[model samples]
Target: MIKNLVHHKDNIVTISETMNCLDAIEILEQHSLRNAPVVDATNTLYRGNIYRYHIYKYKFHHPDADLAQVKVTQFLKNTTRVVHENDSFYQLIFAIRDLPFIAVLDKENVFTGVIQHDVMINYLAQAWVADKSGYVLAIQTRGEKGELNKLARLVNRKADIQSAVTFEKTTYDTSTYLMVTLPEYLDVSSVRALVNDLTRRKYDVNVVTL
Candidate 1:
């Protein structure tokens, strides 16, 4: 799977307790961000998450009021939570819904880094592409060691098949399924004939396209 835990930069959205509602809005707009974390001036303690929706609601009702005059601490949700660097990807997905970020902290609660959603998405996509298409093959063999290697060597010798791979399925016992990419065109009957030959030799072979 994905190995880059610090795939996203650690500069999480943060604001000072002295910041007002207007200041929070400005930070969100400048970064194109929807939310930010409020922190103390010393940066030692997390305050809470400031959401765009709450700011808009406040502005609608108090049209003439000065947002800068209102302290962010007044609106703080007061439920600060964080995630560790060693947390799993599955845990991160759930944490993002409520936290939008997982503040990396030391044992003394010192901020070390941050993880964002965009970076996580990029890392996961790269991992999926690598796992799915790394191997290609075509063969007719029983589910046994050395059988796949023998088919690969045969295809490589003939120069007709460029690459080959085998997939195995086990219900009560294991069976081999083969897939191969070939350069020359072969008709359906010719393919069936090859499969029949493999069956005569006690191989359960299924041809799959790549």
Candidate 2:
């Protein structure tokens, strides 16, 4: 998961606070981005996020205003929407849901870059491993030790595993659920056998998607 979120240095985009609003707007349009991270004059310190719509509105309200002389530093917002480079993957998801992206900072709080919304969504889609050619099983279990190992051992002997993801079904509950994808080679008879085996072991198994 960290590999999906972090190590994205090649895809990050940013702007400098010293840049004029017109220049920033042009860059945003060129890249087709909604928002961008603003950095200090030296481009090392993170300032805040600048939105394309805000710049467009400013231009509309002040048509004769000198856009070249107007710095982006004066109109930046959500300066606190930032996460450290070492932050957990969950933190990145929580921070960027309501925004376009979150600024990434180093140990010294220096501006690095941003994890864009589209990039995160793409990573999550890959993680889910969506497919029409496979069976996805949702198994509900208590937070028990060795349960995963037992399930893996049982399932591996029967069918090829494609992808798996475990998540807490609810924040207030201690119950957890595991979603496993079986290869497309698995047929109805094999799926029924797998389900029966899990039921025999006193585990709740259900077919979620196929």
Candidate 3:
């Protein structure tokens, strides 16, 4: 699923290593960005990133220093983490969690655009669970054989599923949860019946959406 979420290089804004700190700062301000990837003169190679705070710090400590003469690369940080374009959505989610933005690389390992933190949040907000026209059902079942099929059959009897995501919910490995999203057109009575049926079948069911 994540293989399709990558942004291409042409869409990313980057600075060149040859650009001075003043020009780099101007570019950042123009885009209303806190940091941007730095590249070579050809703008194809990934150097590192430069931060706005670092630029100001450099200038503040050296008030008489020529800002235009100082190269942007001097303040570059090597801690930038990049993700591959073909990486799964799950991988991208983990990559961007603690990062302001993550660099994306094409198959050739060329620097592409960045996946900002906000972009991921927006993506999640639009996920099936967040769909207003649907109900997100957090259905808990055991890891035993045919549990998923049983759950599916019960849900299928009442509503059309929009999306389904399953994950282990318990630490001791006693139960698993499936985040199943049912289409919005399904009436409350049908959902209530579905939950009743699931509970009758011994499934721990919870309506996660209002």
For TM-score, the strongest prediction is: 3
Worst 10 residues of 3 by lDDT: 1-10
lDDT of 3 by residue, 55-89 (tens): 99988999999989999989987445778778888
Candidate 2 per-residue lDDT over residues 113-198, each given as its tens digit: 77777778877766666653478888887778998887888888888777887878677865687878887777888988998998
* Stretches of candidate 2 exceeding 4 Å from the true structure: 1-13, 56-70, 125-133, 143-145, 171-175, 200-204, 208-210
**Prediction 2 global C-alpha lDDT:** 0.79
Q: Of 1 and 2, which scores higher on lDDT? A: 2
Best by lDDT: 3
- TM-score per candidate: 0.54, 0.73, 0.81
Root-mean-square deviation (CA) per prediction: 8.8, 3.8, 3.2
Error of 2 at 162 (Å): 3.8
Question: What order do candidates take by lDDT, descending?
Answer: 3, 2, 1
Q: Predicted candidate 1: what Cα RMSD to the true structure?
A: 8.8
